[model samples]
Target: MDADRVNTHTDARSETIRSATLELAQELGFAKLSIEAVAARAGVGKHTIYRRWPSKGALFLDAVLSSHETILEYPDTGDIVADLREQILAAVELLARPPLDGLFRSLLGEAQQDAAISAALNERFIAPQTQRTIDRLEKARDAGQLSPDLDLELAMSILSGPIYFQFLITAQPLTHDYIDRLLAALFAGLGPRP
Candidate 1:
């Protein structure tokens, strides 16, 4: 094969592995996924898997990035509270699913152990999506809705933390009501405490 063909083939093969990783994660989950299973599912050799990703964790992260579930489409409706409420409600709905919630929890644990994986999640997954929400907050501040002194990062953590806490603590049936309750309480104390 020519050099271009070789590179193309490699890229195609890598995508196949990532696709298999997604299916396997849905069925077997991230913690239970294996290179052997991925290779078998992808109809590729173990060497291909080894060449593409250094570990199952890396492969799983790529699969997650490639998966539809990981893609968050947060909207900007000009009304920050309405926008935030919708975004949080969507997140709650997505995460309430069984394998997805389990997969994210597993990913969080794996992220703690793997520096590269954590960096990947933070950069590719979390950072960009987070910037969208933060941008909305910045817009809100600019529009004089949020207090100018509000810390964007801290505001995000406070907003998401309680919902995630509910997911972690009891895996409760999260609803729009819960999202509302969370936003109500957090936003109450976030700004100048009026």
Candidate 2:
């Protein structure tokens, strides 16, 4: 086969594998998901998946992250508060829903015991998302919306910490009102000093 056709074929197989991984994860939860099942679902050999991902955790991370790429992006709406609120709301909606919530919870639970999975989760998902939020916060700071000296990393943590707490710890409902109050307190603290 020609190079272009080969590349297309490879890409198609990768996408099929990712889709299969996600479907199986949603249906069986991450604990029960296995390479054999993914291979059967995708119609690809187990070796093919092994070649692409080092482990089931790596494969699951790729599948979930790729499927929800947009949720990780921070919007630039000029109004930093609005942008942050929009992105946070999107994430809350995702985590508060079925399939993904259970899938993600299972993945996180796995990560807690597996060093490689934990590192991959941080590197692939958490770090990138944190950087995106920091970048947006820096832009807002440059625009005078946030204090120039504000610690962008800390700000990013502040925004996400509570949401994760409620979603993953307290098991509280992630309501729009909750997000609004969170943003209100965040901006209230971040706003210009009197």
Candidate 2 weakest ten by summed lDDT:
1-10
Model 1 / residue 123 / CA error / Å: 1.7
- Would you list the clashing residue pairs of candidate 1? none
Candidate 1 wrongly placed segments (more than 4 Å): 1-11, 69-71, 190-194
Please list the Cα RMSD from the true structure of every candidate, rounded to 1 decimal place: 5.0, 5.0
Task: Estimate the overall C-alpha local distance difference test score of candidate 2.
Answer: 0.81
Model 2: runs farther than 4 Å from truth?
1-10, 190-194
Clashing pairs in model 2, backbone N/Cα/C closer than 3 A: none
The TM-scores, one per candidate, come to 0.81, 0.88
Per-residue lDDT tens digits for candidate 2, residues 40-66, read 999989998887787898888778877
Give the candidate number with the greatest TM-score.
Answer: 2
